[model samples]
Target: MSDSDKAFFTRASELIELANKQNQNKEVKTGEISASFMYAVARYNAWFGSTSFETKEQMQTHKQEMMEYYVERYKEMLEANMNDYIEHFDHYRKTQK
Candidate 1:
């Protein structure tokens, strides 16, 4: 992996750690929200780095298109993951109850 890839992974790991900490503290909602945001941002950055384009103008256009795509996809992923996370937390709560 490139340096950028390593950096992305490091950041993503840190975010996951933060989420785990939140969950351990019984802050399920906050943890999920934070994780979703961090995941979206990290995913976007990773995708942006992976794309290739020649010429400044082409790169700029691609970036714009990618930004839009990432925004929509990230939102969807965030919602789905957040729902899953919340559901998992609820299950834990029920077990404890």
Candidate 2:
């Protein structure tokens, strides 16, 4: 991981925490930001990490491969999270009603 990757993720975490606080204050629950936040983190780690490539074409190729792998994992994790959230919400609603 590069400095940019660490810095971006740390900053993103802080911003998301602030956004959550704002949501709490507003009495809102969107349940839509976590996966997006993680996807950005994955993208930054894949694109911003230090890499030594001999040529422009090499760098481009590497980036494309990295994005492919990262994006696939992101999609899988996002779907899993969504499913977990749906199950949890269903349970909560059942108990509440």
- lDDT (CA) for every model shown? 0.74, 0.71
Tens-digit lDDT track of model 2 for 22-77: 56654545454545656668766856643566666787768777778777977997
Angstrom error at residue 33, model 1: 12
lDDT of 1 by residue, 14-46 (tens): 977866676676646775777687777778685
Model 2 residue 13 CA deviation (Å) reads 7.5
Clash pairs detected, candidate 2: none
Badly placed stretches (over 4 Å) of model 2 are 1-18, 22-43, 49-55, 91-97
Residue 42 local lDDT, model 1: 71
What's the residue-level lDDT of 57 in candidate 2? 79
Report lDDT (Cα) of residue 72, candidate 1: 92
- Residue 54, candidate 1: how far off, in angstroms? 2.0
TM accuracy, model 2: 0.49
Q: Per-candidate TM vs. native?
A: 0.45, 0.49
